[model samples]
Target chain A: MESAIDTHLTACPRTISRRVPDAYQPPFPMFVGRADETLHQVTMAYLGVQYRDGGQRTAALAAVAEIVGTFDIADGPAHNDITRHTDKEGYVNLIVVGYWRDPAAFCRWLRSPDVNGWWDSPERLSGELGYFREIVSPRAEQFETLYAFTDNLPGVGAVMDDISGEINEHAYWGSMRERFPLSQTDWMESSGELVVVTGNPADGGRVVVQGHDNIALIRSGQDWREAGPEERALYLEEIQPTLQAGMDFLRDNGETVGCYSNRLVQNIDLDGNLLDETYNIGHWRSLEKLERWAESHPTHLRIFTTFFKVVADLDKLRLYHEVSVSDGANQIFEYLNCHPSTGMMRDAKVMASR
Target chain B: MESAIDTHLTACPRTISRRVPDAYQPPFPMFVGRADETLHQVTMAYLGVQYRDGGQRTAALAAVAEIVGTFDIADGPAHNDITRHTDKEGYVNLIVVGYWRDPAAFCRWLRSPDVNGWWDSPERLSGELGYFREIVSPRAEQFETLYAFTDNLPGVGAVMDDISGEINEHAYWGSMRERFPLSQTDWMESSGELVVVTGNPADGGRVVVQGHDNIALIRSGQDWREAGPEERALYLEEIQPTLQAGMDFLRDNGETVGCYSNRLVQNIDLDGNLLDETYNIGHWRSLEKLERWAESHPTHLRIFTTFFKVVADLDKLRLYHEVSVSDGANQIFEYLNCHPSTGMMRDAKVMASR
Candidate 1:
């Protein structure tokens, strides 16, 4: 039964709640939580380098290693990881991901002479080497995290103390929104357009595109390394196929449903060997459309039904996701010598030079 | 000299032209051209799978291999490549890229029982395995390609007959836009907001977001595998540092300048080893802001100055890029069980349930 307060809290009649049914027990205990209060805002920074060819990455590798070393020391990121990936153009991306529990610390690190000097160095203009850093800081209320197991947690989990025990909010369509603390009062509505606030490409040099408000970002992860052979078989054979279909629908045809881009990626080791984890990173125009996909799409329905069918027997599988709605004022969209179809460039407006 | 006809062709007085100075030769005679005319509209598709963990990827690998085998048919793509990468969430991603010279052929293949059945199969919804396919088709006029060398051409290069010799347009800030055919007349301005046309996240269902018009995309590449030792040194030591600095400016602080997201990625082989190629794929709000970065920003000036100083000795360095402005209607972005901070979600709008 819904209490008057609960009803009032979720003003929208159709809105879901994060509160679990009274005395309801989950088939398997799962956990999800956020960073400590000290981390009122979390900052994630990806500093990377792109070499023209793989044969000459020694210098680039050393560059990132040094930076990683710097971040590993005191007054640095709470957690950091070095990862690799190759893009459609056959570019190898070496990224050093650093998570800061405090925005002030992140800002301080950025302004530090060591970091600024490295970024401002003239040697970075090599015709064969390219470098970049992408940083985002979201308030505690803007983002959420969930974990399947306590070991080997990624992202904000590094700064978090412990995995809070399950308190409902799983196996449902609107559960994600319900999990978000922001849903209490704010609808998280989107505002503004992907409008150009500066020069156009025709005049050519560097073009900057401004993003809209409340653009949504989601990183859904699944870690099932500890599953027993039988549960693993069930997951691999039964649940996985259904999940793939839903992901495939979004990857190939998500534009129809408001998805901008979706990548179903697996985790790997330094040796290019596969790891025991995988995740789907997607960008949506708004949180509403993402909700609609989960609530009504046939693709997701199959995923929903398939998971529930074997929920009782699947004890080892770990599933969790985190979603954040960003402020447009904090967003960035710039292109250098890149393809016009890259990223937000596909849909942003081109304004005349200011 | 501006021919009367040329003046008439370029309606915008402020727009730059692709024509080079009279009889002016490039330092190393760089080459750039488009894919063969046979490819009126090119379609690029990426088919991939995501597993719960790396330990259980044997099945996923076999699945992709089977699909790759099928795509190798005579009626399949004109070219293809298999690549790998790990994302921020530590997910391993295996991608099989296929390029088609004809969109109709791509359509035909998508509907083929072999491909269609594979995609539509109920077995794909497994809880542990996720699959996805991303496809994009751009008309000949909508895209432009450039190459520093003839060998190891990527993207449309596989379909091209030869690397057309230098035709004069080189070494300029606005060169990318000048290289684009659409820039000759069309301003490529954006025309819509990222609006929600359906259900909100609160509704707990699938929601569809609508995109606007005239979004741009760019794929700028650098292949220095064939560069001489001295040129490589110049690139690795002198030129690279400066380029990295500029890229860093965009990556770290580009939000203030209008960039949505930028990734400087290198190309890697299957073994997770670095390759001899690299590129930067960026998403901008518009072509205009990109131009501003290039034209007035000091970061790009260093890139331009450094290249000019060493242009004479850089004989083996290969640098090329392709830019395209997409129709927003053809775009797709969706997220399922993903972290909220992924991709364009950082600044998109969120509408209420309709």
Candidate 2:
């Protein structure tokens, strides 16, 4: 039965998996046999310009802020896995990550007119720019993922249910493989397994995985004091459904055995901004298993397709994946212990100081 | 007799001479030697300090201007190598090059009361100051030399006269060797033969030598309209002498060789502020030669000893060195037809435009 679906899916060139091990199987029972599914990882980069002149610098910053404000998640079926950072005094770098069913569906989003319009915006001008360079190589060469820890668990039907619900509602990833097939292969071949572990390591915690290039911890900020009541309510209501949808997709198509997941709150900075706010980090038995889930799973496909459509017009919101190899711990202890400086955290800290 | 001199000079750490294959002794007994007799390269970084409340930037700029104004040949010896560039809004970056007997000699002048007092002077003080950070590294890597193209047909009498004159006026080599024996060996070993060519490749025009890692050019800037009469006179009378001294030192030391020297220049800003400036970039036939010079020379010893004495009291000065390798043609094209850029070239162009 599983072989039958695999044959059927092979008809779609965009949905074809690069190399799937014969022993591959899904963690959960689904409509299609686990043997039939394919998975792919995708990464994208969004560069923000910073001009040398003060006036132009101001203009660039404003444009970036405006773009970030327009990020939406309801426009398509794509799933979003993204992170953003800025050099205190220089440029802004954004990385977006997610999975896809195949390359064909991914290509449709790249050629979209919405993305082109943002690049051609009138306000995107630099003053006396000295260095303006861009680089795009396979994430495998650029970075490595050595460590990952999370609290969510596989077989928790609730999480998988949420993921499927979100995908069905948004219909995001179905067409991406045909549109951006190359991107899917590039990401899958380059990225490593996403490791998910249990517990908060910061509050007298320990990491389950020993060697990883990057570690993303997932947690909820329900206890965070800086968030106003209204803000907290709005976040829980809006994000829960989306997050549930993601969980549902993973439960149905993800592989089990040697897999892990974790849930944690976001890290915050001194300025009340989100530091590292990844929704969840999951560890697969191998990259091969992750690829399978991404390729043939309908729920996973819908999540990603919707994500790209929502932020397609926003220049600041980028989607990319990085595959890094970490020889030793690159992150400092101080960075790991601190919450990002959000208003809730700042207020709580102030109260404690007093 | 020539063999005897070669034997003696070869043994003398301070003296370097290359034997002519067939001594058809021209008008002067021409014995080629290495240039940059000072045998030391010094690098200094100037940092401007500004206040926390935006006053620091202006203060830093002013301090930069003040430092640039104090450049002079008598302070030590300059090699006509200086670079000054500014951004679009006319902020400045100034680098001055010159040669010194050693770091001690350079530092004493740098930290002298006269130089330090300028920082406190009411007219110059902005309550914002700039400082120097010194870095001294013996050149032990990335050094090479290629010597060619010289006037070989000069009468033996003329050559002898030139050699004798050099010996009489700058016979400091003997005592210098006595004081610092190790400094002399590296140069003696690396010094190449003095070849007399048929024509002056660098005569009446500019000779531009550019390589993968190095660039050296000598030209007449008589027509460049970048400076006023005072600046022009200063360039001709004051700057020219120092430049000539360097050229003569190179000619006497070896037929043609490369050595590090100091960079010196008058720091003039777009706002027309003048700065007192002094720094060094020692050169040698090779990195080994530089290292030997640093370890052995007595003049260098005395110079460095003096430098540390005043360093404790100085407001600022810095020194460091970087070694680089080259592969492509190191020597660029020689322009025999054109005159160097003097202040007059701009005026001629402007008049023509009118």
Q: Pick the candidate with the highest lDDT.
A: 1
Clash totals for all candidate models: 143, 180
C-alpha lDDT score of every prediction, in listed order: 0.59, 0.28
lDDT (Cα, 0-100) at B328 in candidate 1? 69
Per-residue lDDT over B216-334 for candidate 1, one digit per residue giving the tens place of the 0 to 100 score: 55556666787888878877887677777777676667667666545455665444456777666555666655655554454555565566566555567876666665666555443
- Provide i-RMS per model in Å: 26.1, 34.2
* Each candidate's DockQ: 0.01, 0.00
Residues A1-354, model 2: lDDT tens digits: 122122322334432331211222222221211112233222222223334334544454444444333333222113333333332233332323222223334345434555445544332322232111111111212222111111221111111112111011111111122112232222223123322132223331222222233222111122223345554444355443555565544433233422233222233332225652333433333332343344323333344333333333322222222221222132111111112221011111111221
Candidate 2 docks at the CAPRI level of incorrect
Instruction: Name the TM-score of chain A in model 2.
Output: 0.28
Query: Could you give candidate 1's per-residue lDDT for residues A186-234 as a string of tens digits?
Result: 5676675566565454443344667777777777766677888887787
Superposed by TM-score, candidate 1 places the C-alpha of residue B166 at a distance from the truth, in angstroms, of 58
Chain A TM-scores, candidates in order: 0.76, 0.28
Tell me the deviation in Å of residue A300 in model 1.
3.6
